[model samples]
Target: MTSAASKTFVRRLGVLLGAAGLAAPLTVAMGATAQAATSACTAGTGPYQAKAERFLGRTVDGKQSAADCRAIRDFQLDHGISPAIGYAGPVTWAVMDLVSQQRAAGDNPNAAGRCPVNKGRIACVDLTRQLTWIQDGKRLKSGPVPIRSGRDGYETRTGLKKIYWRSIDHWSTLYEVRMPYSQFFDGGQAFHSIDGSVWSAPGSHGCVNMRRADARSYWSLLKNGDDVYVYGRKPGT
Candidate 1:
């Protein structure tokens, strides 16, 4: 269970960052409305929501912002990951720890090579194929996997990113989603694993989802600030 203090921390962080909406818990029927509200702010409208503004300022190829209500609107059009209040609760943290433990044991996803820790290695994944690979010394070492893309057609974006944010045991028990950046773009899509084979299908709303096994494997190889190359499908399609 999360200490009451931790819950407060998460809530404060959300409000200070203009991400208080994210802190709101999701519901089966109202979840869509909540996420859609994220993009309601215009470039200069409302109180200076620093987190929202910062997210909105970033552009994918000069387009898309974490605060784009249109993106939120798009999500409602098809429904997507609900950043419900408990989504980033204590359970998420625990799972991340487990994944870290397994990876620290020297398990290699592709048996290809070490994940690149250099300035030039290509770190990327293919959601269509459910594979996350690292650029070894000279080649791409692939890890077996399955991912959930956007069910609403807001596909996982294709781009270059550095590990930006991370949270353990997000959402529910044993589920952790590693975010390369803030969930600003398309409401901050994530790379996470769900409980069943649902991930193998187009299960996620827009996040790059993986199976529990594959997610665990990735947790071992990746770290914050690392670069990742996403191929096949644009993020938050």
Candidate 2:
């Protein structure tokens, strides 16, 4: 072949090879996406299938379906469960159970009279239900909101305490983490905001981990010397 013709052929071949390379990655990416979607929404029945179905308001047939998988997966993702693949496993069911109890509290979280009512402007932490609220002589000032207390070994201390310190932007030297809107009621444990999901599990290191918005609200509503009553028992602990 002539030099000019050979050069033109080489250019065309290069273009074709580049296009093929691009298509290869595209195809692999598509396959990976499909696999992920499939894994994230399995059809196999989990141990707590029936309870999960009932909690999710789905038909309690005690079986896993495509629809059930999707619904359960969504709930898992919302609550920050790992491998949120729509599995009705114990973790998912446990979270659902906690949610049910929280909802049952409704507007009157203190209806059971667990947290003292007469304390003027007091913060109540119900460790059993993983809930917290602020009340003033029976009037709900704020919350009944979700909270992630300390883990099994590092259970948040129970009993009446006071907010001894307040730091809007506190950094934990021990854990090397940022504790935003920290209000310390105990030695090292405090009410603070974490960047991660408050419902992620295993809980914190004796601190009451709150969502960002909830922590900010707590910062605004609480101050030094405010009463804090922590009661009940955290489930795993």
Candidate 3:
């Protein structure tokens, strides 16, 4: 026989877990409800979403399902993605691509290395991956975003650099173009969203080009004096 106070404490813990969606209560239709939650994507959806559905272990028909989002979020957590919103956003997609690339190449999918010592909010770039990740030293805050660095001629300088400047809407006088959410690390190289094909090509002259949304996110995350470490050679380099 348990004490009343002990029983109340357990019940309160259950409520907190339930509120956080950590544990669902014992519902009437646990079996049937499970099926409904794991919905398949319907037709007319983008191939990318279908890929995400499959990656999430959900039916890849073409549909939106909370179950899929939860799976995606869980995957993100395992991969060191932050917030774990469950939405297959730009950051998620970028990570997915990186994983796919690694799998295809028979390489390790967990592609993180030792971060810079004492570098708070470090921005890490894997040239081999063509990916960027922002983290507070050991903890990832955002990214694994697809990025484009200098092409054949003008290779983006590698090695560790510190962010020294930031601009919300900066126009590059050297390139004569607009660089949104620009965080400058190397002398003339910065991480900024550009109008180019970052998904398929390393199209930048030398600066890092990110997707518009990712640039916005980077702007919100990084600040001056943050360490930026660019490592590994870009694929096919």
Candidate 4:
């Protein structure tokens, strides 16, 4: 073979080797991710293992299993729980418990009559259940949706209040955060949308933190002077 042709062949071989080297790591990374997703399930039993098992309709054994981990992890991921490794920790159980409460509410969240039916076109917030809904007399207008209310020390004030102000693009000066679809009902407290998951531990500062869709719907359904009845104590507060 000619010297020039030999040199060209060597250059092509070098390029092929380099490309294979790069492809090898990429293939390994993809495989690792897939393996981690399936194999990262915790083997040790979580504190709420039995409760989680019961909730998920798995065998009532408190011990953790690969199956249990997969089931719990799926639930955690579905609820936006972070580090969703399938551990039945307090946070996971708390969310599951909340789901149970919401299911019990069914079609009539106001069946208990805790929220006064006399008020027309009012928004009712049940802090205990971490749920909120809008009602026009006896008619359910929207949600028994999950909410993240004031955490511990910053408990949301309970009482009958009215939305006195609204800012679609509100930027909080005190907290230095964006509070989208803000509807202020009491003091600095308001119904607002947060970027994070509502089920996140502890809770919000003092406002009713809702998902983006829920906040938008609330903004459209409610207006200034709309009655907002905030009652019941939030679990931790």
Among the numbered candidates, top lDDT falls to: 2
CA shift at 13, candidate 2, in angstroms? 36
Taking the tens digit of each residue's C-alpha lDDT, what string does model 2 give over 31-141?
554465345454478889999999989999998998998898889889999667677888889899999999898889999898888779999999999999999989999
Clashing pairs in 4: none
Candidate 4 segments whose C-alpha is farther than 4 A from its true place: 1-39, 80-83
Per-residue lDDT of model 4, residues 1-237, tens digit only: 566875576567647756754211111123554465355564468899999999999999899988998898889878888657677888899889988997788769999898988989999999989999999999999998889999999999999999999999999999999999999999999999998888777888889999999999999999999999999998767
Better of 1 and 4 by TM-score: 4
Quantify all predictions' global Cα lDDT against the true fold.
0.46, 0.87, 0.69, 0.86
Error of 1 at 66 (Å): 51
Better of 1 and 2 by TM-score: 2
| Residue-pair clash count for candidate 4 | 0
Q: What TM-score quantifies how close candidate 3 is to the native fold?
A: 0.54
Q: Give the clash count for each candidate.
A: 23, 0, 5, 0
Q: Candidate 4 at residue 151, lDDT?
A: 98
By TM-score: ranked, best first: 2, 4, 3, 1
lDDT of 3 by residue, 97-211 (tens): 7667645533222234545646777888777767777877566678667787877787788898999999989998887889998899998899999765574443577788888
